[model samples]
Target: MSLPLAPGLAGTRILLGISAGIAAYKSAHLARLLKKSGFEVRVVMTEGAQAFITPLTLQALTGEPVRTSLLDPEAEAGMGHIELAKWADVILIAPATADLMARLAHGHADDLLTTLCLATEARCLMAPAMNQAMWRHPATLANADRLVELGWILLGPDAGDQACGDVGLGRMLEPETILAQLLDELEPARDEALRVMPVHRDLVGRRVVITAGPTREALDPVRYLSNHSSGKMGYALAAACAERGASVTLVSGPVTLSTPPGVERIEVISAAEMLTAVESRMPCDLFIGCAAVADYRAAAISEHKLKKTEDASGLTLELVRNPDIVATIAARPDRPFTVGFAAETQALETHAGSKLERKRLDLVVANDVSREGVGFGGDDNAATLLWRERERTRRHTLPRQPKTALANAIVDHIADRMR
Candidate 1:
């Protein structure tokens, strides 16, 4: 979301630092996203980062001249690093390489970026990206711990497939995820601080059950059908609820996201498994069905992998309807306040309203997934929340925003309704 409407971050200055790594390419997008969010962004690049991505690219994206050399006589005539350092409200190093992290931890100021880091009093944040092995190394771990102890915030070294054809932790978070997290960490204006108050424990005695991600429909032991659900929204909701002191149980489908702190995560694969898991966590105060459960699954499980026949031109498999997880829970006589999500490509309101009534849901969050930059596998989302109040249906519209922000707003609404 753009920060223009946010009092504290409206004109926030961000010093975007890029270090050497394949992930440096993502820094370009990071710069753009920050700029789009109304943050004044300036970029400083390590010499090695220029090898992977050029300063010109970032300069163009941020609309600010990029700084490369620490001792460029023309720029340093005014102690450019110090000036840039003083200009920033926050210093964020994306693709903070292992070498850079080590240097930062040990007080090295060898380059413009590192030098600015040393000269800046602004809050320091890093998004570390390196080979999985390097990230897990004893020295790297020590440096990371030390950086945190020194008041530096570590964004993520997300786990997943890497450029080296090996998969594990060490990937930098997506630009949108980084932006969302940065906003969440920053304190809003005092008058607006209560909007996302840290000390609030409004859900202290509540129990929340949330389902997230895309359920896989097994076609065989090796193949399955699933959607492009990253489980980000659901996980965000779980985190928000947990932060508010709610006992949150997250019934999640296969997704790579890290479990949020204080949340109980139960992993499952198929829609049936998710349904069973949710049912087992029943009798909760609130139930949020956010999973993209497949509408159909293989009607019959094959004993072995199906092989293509030389004589046959094509093949067909029978499919059957899968159980409607949210509807089933809502139908229960002991149902809690049930919330459902309707992710539609078209006629969003019509579909969502139908689910709210047909499934007997307390609320239905209608999402238009066809929109770019928000929905499905992305880090941002927009929705129309529909619910029945008194004798008529009421709706609230939430503009496109970081899933974390959206989740917080959704929870706040739910809390208000519950009260």
Candidate 2:
């Protein structure tokens, strides 16, 4: 599928940096994808990259002349690097070789790409592509981390088979993945302009707490009662808030989703444990109850496996209610903007509206979990946001998108409400 370009990139200039690596072949596809997505793409190559991919290939895909030299007289009409730097909305380097990474880390600007990178005020993203061992080496990892610290978005060196008959994690991500990430970085909802607004900074120094995933209530040590929630939505919220300069604490139930880049994560297994985790982060600016906590738990613990008798058809077990974490937090005297999620199978609005009132939430995000490709483990989600006032309800039908995109949208709504 053709991924959507960043809204900001329409008619926007993008400088594509291709470095020497076997993965340089993929840069041709990356350029084509960028052009198809409405970007005015300009390709810049290093001397080493020319060995793997011809300039003719990139020139054809980009529909623009490729620039590979810092000393080109025609390109230097207006101080080439500075002009190119000012022309771009973003600088993306794919197949960023280990050598190039080291040069960037040490502030080396010997080549055209590095020079443009250093001179640009635009956002920068790098997709590192190298041999597995080179990627794993301490120096490369440290350089990558340093780039991140300097505000560069590192796309990936995903794990997979390598060209040299070896495999483990140094493969450059597919072109589509890199393009998707670039779109995200370029279209971040909470832009720098928003940051300077007085209303935007309301949650500036506030500690925001969130819960995510399905809590597993053990029926036995081997089995548990849990839903199919992937914890993606909640994790996305945590990451979004953190990006907007909020101090965030994520109390997450058992999930495979990685912790969002800068947020603090506390892991828990059962509903009771989740309650404790939420309670511990109280008196924050915002509290989000996104976890699908089990309403009932096994009343008694079992020390050992119970034997099934041939004569018995079934076994009886008592159940008890788990603590209502959101309600409890809302009841606090100094409550933050309380948000809760209502995943319903039927009568979505009516049920969500009632839940919003009963739970005393500032806002509730309700969705039909019954719909295919929207809720639970799916990457995309569609939600109807209901405010406590009862008269205002907005339907936000997010396209089948990455969880992070949905998360950004959710946080943007919250930020708007705060205003």
Candidate 3:
């Protein structure tokens, strides 16, 4: 999903600091994504990160030569470190490794990255990436807490499979996810302080399930059919709900979107797989069908690639309709407050209204995909929410905003309805 660029970061200068860790590889992508999101990115890499990724790669992505050594004589002209430090609007450190964290905690300015951090007054954002054990270490936690107290933004050590072949916490957030978080921080909600100060425990203990992305229907061993669903909306909803203290379970189709912090994500592929996964986690307080499930799948599976024969003029494969997952869930006796999405080209209200009634959905979010810039695969979305009664319906024409912002709005509406 495309996120609306915040004025706070657009054309703003950002100094990206890369440190040593397995997650350094992600820093390259993060730098590129940041540049694409309209930040002027300058990369500063520690010697350790250079061990894993090339300075050339980061330079290519940022369109600026990578700065590594603190002692480079040419770079030191006119007090380069201090000058670069003063030039930044924000200093973001990705893969802020355990070693770096310790150094930063104690104000150790041994390297260029650390020295720059000490020299700069720019807002700092750090993404701690390390082994799960290292992340949980008492010293690391204390240092991180101290950093947070000092007004540094901590992005994530998201829970998931780590490069160390162990699954738990301590995974660096994906580039797009980090970019979204950065946007959120830079362009905080107009009423962010007020909203956060209030405790809306309306969903304090509620279990909410959300599905996201486009399901892949395998056509062969290597080929598959999928839609343009980016999973951005669903992931954003998950994050929003979690922020509201809801226990969120995200049953996601294949997408590059990262699982929101504090969300339990169950990854699946085909529509059938999604169904099985959701059903296994049923009896929740809410179920959101945000994924674009494939309508049909190959009727028969082929073990190998079907080769063309000399006499064959063409090949036709049969297809069968995939199960309607949301409808089936809504039909259950223990169904949660069901929400579905309707993406239409024409007669959006008419079609979405029908779907709402026919599928027994408590709420349906309808979007006009036919319009430019506001639907399927785009970061921004404009939705007209539909319910049984016309008076109860509400049309929310969201500005060309981030999908996460839209998701937060949708979740707020849902929470209000639940209350």
Candidate 4:
């Protein structure tokens, strides 16, 4: 399953403020990186910073005109500062010099950047940069603490060689590091917002049952057979469902992942146990079979660990077919809107459609596991959705994306189809 193309930073707005400091030079690269990563970047330079780097440099890098004043009548006629403040999703102050930190900490709105910081409801993050002595100054430390107490997220003034011959803390983090941290802070908020969107919130108050990971088929007392399913996909589905306010029961096989928030998790080791768990939590509004269940198990159990014999003859064990959990549930008179997963290496749609019909599933998420980032242990996936529309089978291709993103899309689709 090859996911569709995505602009990683589309619709995300970032207001970048540069304060006076030699490290202000780094803001250029940061602006460019933020843009490249899908953020709408707008740069603001403090008066003192213009001496270190030209506004033209940042403006050119960010593709937006630089804003550097608190009282430009032409702009102020429309209360442009207020508009700029309201437009930001996050305000980042890189190269936040000691003086600038103090101004913001004391709630000074003397400049356009500082004024916007005061006006905007967006989250504020500062990356302090200065000489070690100045950085270690008690007043500076107090200002930093004050800013932190005011709900400002302060990124590192990392320890390293300073521009001033001396070496210690007070170096600005690399542009890449700042971008990664920025995304980490904002992505959760974005996901949370998406969770409540009217279009994506259809699952609210609905009951969902999701099975994930691989079941172990016992071969002997100390041996068992299992696939490479890491259970990440199923876990993501559970989390996505919970985010949409669904009452979710995640029947998970042996995996190291934590239970998703707002989800009830049932841990099981074998196919029989998994089926038992699913049956007990039944009468769900939706059932998603994402687990990679072993098709067969040993016909008989061995009380002791099987050992190699002196003759070295290969051991032979009889096997029996395991219960088809998803099909059994779908066969019920009061079955939920049943869904299943098909991880295939070849003929993906063909095999997936077959499974959808064979199991009588309302929807099937078919993944070409052979594609990179689609299946197994990875944090990302790409999938094709197969659902019966009257007598025809409809397919939708979802591009490769983080598992959480894919899960949300899938859940939204399920909701739409149900409606």
Candidate 5:
């Protein structure tokens, strides 16, 4: 399914400046992505940026002429640099080199890109990309701090493998991430509302193990049974938990989601595999079985591939119950604060209450997947969080919002209780 876009990103004017770095190649893809996402994208290249990537290539991708020089008299006649700078709502510098960053900090405008950066009232954002050593250098560090102090937004210099074969910090964040940050910049109110939520490092030193996504029950070698779970909620939970200083281990089912930073990820395909994984990460402070593990699996396996019968004979196969991962964990003598998710189509509160009692769960987050944009494969969700402790039952309603925000709220609730 196509992921939803940033609010108000469509038709927003964005000025993208490319700098000298191997990561410049990524900016080509970034330009194409922004344009496709409905941003009015324009490209500016420094002389050094031109060396790494051609102007024509960026021009073709942006569907507009690329600007490169500080002094092109013909273009200067119209003061094109100033015009372009004024046209932008936000100026994004990707693959922003240490040199460029230093120049920006010191108020240098010797180049067209830097000149435009000064000429505009538009918001300025930078994504630093360079060698680990360069990124760590005291000079670069000071420059970065200065930029931040001057109200210039600096995005990630993510740690990963670099082109120079050295490993450490200094990889530019992917285009998708930069785009998300871009949205946050464009819509500060969305971010501000999140900041008011009650969450902190209250889970520090806690160990959190969460299961996410849909478990696949194999019917044949090539086919399986799974749900419409995108694993987004669980992944968001993993991220939120980590952000709260918890040591998070994510036992994830088959899903195309990236591991949250600083979280350990365990990939499993089937329900049985999921149970084993969750059990192995034992004695954690919390165990959240957010995975949509299949209730049953094929009772027998065929040695070879199953094929359709041309004679129209129907085939039947036996099925068996899969292990109850969350219940089993909750029953452990050293059980952590167990949390489970009930993505119900009907009677959400009733089913959630039953699950909480049946599994002896500390909490159950119940959401009506039947409601559009609330659960399953969407970006947002709403839920009724039911709790049971010492025979007392309580529940709180989580308002409809982004899964990230909802996950934060869940984490906040758990953290507040634990504290």
Candidate 6:
């Protein structure tokens, strides 16, 4: 199905930057899609990119001469790079390789594509493509983080099969998906209030507190209990709130994700530590308890690692219930508007609704973690928002999508309810 075009995208100018990767083949289809969608399309090809897809093919699709050189005498006569930079409303680089990301992050204007990226005042979007290992490497992660810090948007390095027979994240998102993300950024939410608002930063002057990641409950000095929460959803929500001008404080548990720009992050490990950290940032305009806190902890922690005796078949330890962070917050006399997340294995809606009533939460975001790609450590999510509204309960289901997009949707709902 064709996607709906946003009102703000009328007469939009797009400069498509293709980097070298096996995913470069997808760029041809991307260029055609952009042109067919009524965007004024232009193409820029890296030298290595020419080996995968010829400039002539892209030129044919875009109806514009593909530019590949930083030193083209004819084009440079008019300072072509500067002109191209000014003409675009957005620069979209598909198959943005790890090397290209590193160069861009470090301000390397050594090639035509990089040079134009440096010169452009336009918003930049990158869809990274590489091997799974490379994508997960610390260096690449740091580079990607730095680029985001510099106001660049990353679409996806979606998880799945790759050209090299490796299966994991590092596949560039499909062209349709990338275009949808771009459209979302360019336009307001399809709501009357957001459409008429002068500034899209709806959370301005609001204080938001978020909890994230899996809290570790120590059983011994060397052992702990935790979950597979990667903190992606919570972190995405934090970024969305910050983008809307909220003063956000993220009370995070153990996770390797970087702190979103414009957010204050407090690091903790155990559930108790997380509770203390969250309580200290209380009385905010909104509070989202997104953390996957452990339900139990060792009643008596062993200072030393427990060793299994050969004669004993198994070892047993006493356990105690951990404090329920979200429930406690909702029970507060002066509680802020509270939201909780329910990661369920069955009866998604039923459990979510129960959480809403039982915990006294203003809203509960429910997701089935049993699904393949939409929960737990994955980058995408589909959720149902359950809440009580006067005489009836309301339920809104969000389809499977990148956590970034889903986060924005959740924030929009929250903002609407607040209004």
Cα lDDT tens digits, model 3, 6-60, are 5555688999999999899988888878887788999999998889999999999
lDDT of 4 at 416: 87
How does candidate 3 fare on TM-score? 0.56
Local distance difference test values of all predictions, in order: 0.85, 0.80, 0.82, 0.84, 0.84, 0.86
Q: Each model's TM-score, in the order given?
A: 0.55, 0.55, 0.56, 0.55, 0.57, 0.55
Best by TM-score: 5
TM-score of structure candidate 6: 0.55
Clashes of 1: 0
Per-candidate total of colliding backbone pairs: 0, 0, 2, 6, 0, 0
Give per-residue CA lDDT, model 2, range 54-159, as digits (tens): 9999999988889999989887987977888998888899989999989998899998999999999998888888886787576776777677667777776555
Model 2's TM-score against the true structure: 0.55
**Which stretches of candidate 2 lie above 4 Å from their native place?**
1-203, 390-401
The pairs that clash in candidate 4 are 1-368, 3-398, 3-399, 3-400, 4-399, 9-38
Count steric clashes of candidate 3.
2
Residue ranges of candidate 4 with Cα displaced over 4 Å? 1-199
Worst 10 residues of 3 by lDDT: 193-202
Per-residue lDDT of 249-340 in model 5, one digit per residue for the tens? 79999999987754667889999899888888797899889999899899976667888888877878899999999999999999998999
How much does each candidate deviate from the true structure in C-alpha RMSD? 12.2, 10.4, 10.1, 14.8, 8.9, 12.4
Candidate 4 structure quality by residue, lDDT tens digits, 1-419: 11111345466789999999999888988988888777788988889999999999998887799988889898899999999999998899998999999999999999999999999999999888888778657688678767877878766665456789865456787777777656656665544633433323455446689999999998877899889999999998987776554557789999999766445678899999999999997787899999999999999989889888789678888999999999999999999999999999999999999999999999999998998766999988999999888799999999998887888889989888888
Q: List the residue pairs that clash in candidate 3.
A: 1-379, 2-379
